[model samples]
Target: MWLLNGQSTWVNGYFYPGENIWAQCDLDCHDVDLVLYDRNGRWVAEDTLLDDLPIVQAPYEGSFAVQVIMAGCRHPRGCAVVVDSDYGF
Candidate 1:
């Protein structure tokens, strides 16, 4: 989980294969984008739009990368980001 304090981007470097990744944003975050990248820096999947919901499944057994971007928001309390995966880290 991350508390985005006016920052629009966050990155993670550890993800497992065959694991289903999901990211949920706080209500304050109106628009958020989530993207998954392979070990080689290739885009695996991306989720955009308010209701699209960023979700991706690992393609192979290796460490992957994840990126979350806060496109728009309207809360003085900032936004919360929760990331989860099916497999144990």
Candidate 2:
């Protein structure tokens, strides 16, 4: 998924406490961030590293969302990001 600078996408799912989510991009993308938000959009966990891979963990079990943000991309147009999780069947 290609996203422009400062662009964000939301992933909504049912996650148990301690679940994990990962956002990975190619070398073209230098900075990507993942943020975990509660059902009410409250902040939970986040990974904002200078590397292309970022991850976050679930703090509570219930309806929650993960926001993927593209902070910086070496690509001209946008950065391609793949979001994955260890939870779910």
Which candidate's lDDT is highest? Answer: 2
**Residue-level lDDT tens digits of model 1 in 1-89:** 54454355545556665678777777776666678887778898877756525777777777777777665557666677777778644
| Candidate 1 collision pairs | none
TM-scores vs. true structure, each candidate: 0.72, 0.89
lDDT of each: 0.68, 0.84
Model 2 spans with C-alpha error above 4 angstroms: none
- Name the lDDT of candidate 1: 0.68
Relative to the true structure, candidate 1 reaches a TM of: 0.72
Supply candidate 2's per-residue lDDT for 86.
83
Model 2 Cα lDDT, one tens digit per residue, 1-89: 78987789987878877878888987788899998888888898889877788978877778888889999887788888988878652
Per model, how many backbone clashes are there? 0, 0
The Cα error of candidate 2 at residue 46, in Å, is 1.2
Model 2 / residue 52 / CA error / Å: 1.2
Please give the lDDT score at residue 30 for candidate 2.
88
